[model samples]
Target: MAEYIMAEKNNRMIPEEDKIFALNARAKKMSEEVGRDKVINATIGSLLDDDGKLVMLLSVVKALKGLEPLDFAEYAPIGGTTDFKKAVKKAAFGKHRSSSFVEVVATPGGTGALRNIVANYSKIGDRVLTSDWFWGPYKTITGELYRELCLYPMFDENNRFNKKGFSEELNKLAADQESVLILLNTPSHNPTGYSLDGDDWNGISEAVKEASKKARITLFVDAAYIDFAGDEEEYRTFLPKLEDMPSNVLPVIGYSFSKTFTLYGMRCGAMIAMAPSEEIAAEFKLVNEFSARGTWSNSTRSGQVLVSKVYEDEDLLESVNKERAGYREMLIKRGKAFSNSVIEAGLPLVPFDSGFFSCIPLKDPAAVSKRLEEKGIFVVPLAKGIRVSVASISEEICRKLPGMIAEVIE
Candidate 1:
């Protein structure tokens, strides 16, 4: 018998352990970064009130109040409310599909839909493709499941979509894996507030088709901000992927009422999967239903009921839509102001056209964020650039962005 001796080598993590720790640490750091407070957040995604409070979409809340009658005491079905699912489909993919062909499931939020979409399409170690410009949560949600978040370049130096870079990335992923996933966020992007142009959508579609020819790839579109993008018809008409509803190339959309109707804390959203055939759609429905059961056990039943009720009421929806359009245009004003100041200051501009987020390329993202915070401004720092949440920022706050960056530079 030999006595065991304590050794430092035993404490060292194996390769798998090291990789897990890296992921854990990255997620932890991100959670902390997004939780910071702000006197004037030039880099926020949520809308703010005139008093600098987070704007609660009162219309949605009022709509939700009617659902109190539904009772939380009752356990909702795994598939969620039928009315809610129908509403989601009407709002998301429209009536393009054969009525029986369309299917949807309630999810905790758009993010829940995202997880469900990914789970239905992929397995561990599968390559998930998204634009280099993307929501931070993609890494947390996809990576934790052991999938790789592959990034294709989104915009060029002028902040326009880079088709070649996108094509290359898709081709590479298709060649390397049996299946690949591509996530497209529009009519606007988070943290950048940009949407794809007409030409860009065409390029992306061809790229998706090209990649699909090589390997089985799913296109997941996050149309979370479709309500704020000014023109729904333009988006609906152009994103041929949504209208055509391809079969070999599956397209799943994550629709969130959280932003459009301003129901943030309520957490209401749905996932709609468009498969080539009803059989495949049914298969996805089963996975999504199971995901709903296992994940959150159905989204807020009351919230779903409330939104459905609102959708059915044309008079109510029209008023809400008009008011929402007003709020959305203000965001455009605020963002343009920020862009103008950045231009005047001779700072680099990150093209933002669609959603609430935009970024400026900086030498050090963390340093720039700190300096902005010191000036009573707060923002998000990303690998490629500094993300600005234009919807939450006021014209006054937006005007100060360039000066804040100048101070950081000095």
Candidate 2:
């Protein structure tokens, strides 16, 4: 009798738990043991009010409640409703009209969109490229799909985007692989909260255009936190640059409503492609839809309906934006408070612009995180740093955390 009775491929897959959620559970247990007010739970990625309650947009909630039973109960189309697709395009592109052919495919969330991209775009055992400082799930997704995740140093000595390093790695990858999938998470990136500016985007575009001469390049933009980044129109200025890429280079946007609409559990999002040709656009839709059918067949109808309704009605859209803006401001305040405190405490943090989470880069992240946990401060320790969720903590906690972390580090 063998100690293990699983397939060869499944043999290496060990039962592992998500570090963030595991820490969150421990935080909740501590909250119950010692009063909730005494513990600072910065492990969760979701936005929480100053009162430590999860924040949900009332307008979005009302819109969902107003939906007819059939609207939610009925199964959505394999791809998505036509109206929903249109709404997603409008939401993603904003005022930037592209000359290239575009297509959209509904996904469970941004994660599903990423999965489809990895499944359809890259071959097995191929390398998927991204920044070294990335969302941990990127590795998990690629590993599960029988692909490898590769990295480029995210920043330079000046703490700016490392365009040179990116181009170097991209060229290196293109030399070996015929097709390359590059995942760029920006406009409020996870953990680090770093957003690439226009200069950064320009550098990226130039690099991609140059690399496309040799290999087929799929530029995947994970824009999950775009809505919370900053000025709505200003943050989206980089989108138009993706329009004029070479025929071999495809720009795909992964849009998620989980953060924007606060519908995390609903798992609603879309994978949008800006193709240089009609044939490419058609193939993008067909391949992703086929992958969706094989995986999670249909998305949440209610969530799609909610987004469609919000975009379809001008007033509803305005209301939803207004409500969401308030929460965005709250998040900004919390982030600012934490940043300011870190500065005052002489604590070094990763380049943080605007987002739910920021990271403090230090050696022995796990050990430091354990020390923080002993003090009833729960945070997710990453490979290079500990992630502090400013969105989940109050402004007061945000102000206090830096000093506490600094003390622990010292």
State every prediction's TM-score relative to the real structure.
0.86, 0.97
Please list the residue runs of candidate 2 whose C-alpha ends up more than 4 Å from where it truly belongs after superposition.
1-15
Question: On residues 1-410, what C-alpha lDDT tens digit does candidate 1 reach at each position?
Answer: 13335633322222333332343344345446664333554444577754556766667666666666544555556777888887787777543443335578888879898988877788787878888878877877786667778888787766678988889998998898888878888777875677878788888888877887888877788889887777666666554555453456777778998887888777889877766778978888898898777778767777777778878998777777777878878776777888888888888876777667678877898777766655555567778778776776677778877777776777
lDDT of 2 at 358: 95
Provide backbone clash counts, one per model. Answer: 11, 0
Question: What's the lDDT for residue 323 in model 2?
Answer: 91
Model 1, stretches more than 4 Å misplaced? Answer: 1-38, 93-100, 243-246
lDDT of all predictions: 0.73, 0.91
Instruction: For residues 180-293, write the lDDT of model 2, one tens digit per residue.
Output: 999999888997999999999989999998888889999999999999998888999988888868879999999999999999999999999999899999999899988999
**After aligning candidate 2 to the native by TM-score, how far in Å is the CA of 365 from where it should be?**
0.1
**Least lDDT summed over 10 consecutive residues: which range in candidate 1?**
11-20
Instruction: Choose the strongest candidate by lDDT.
Output: 2
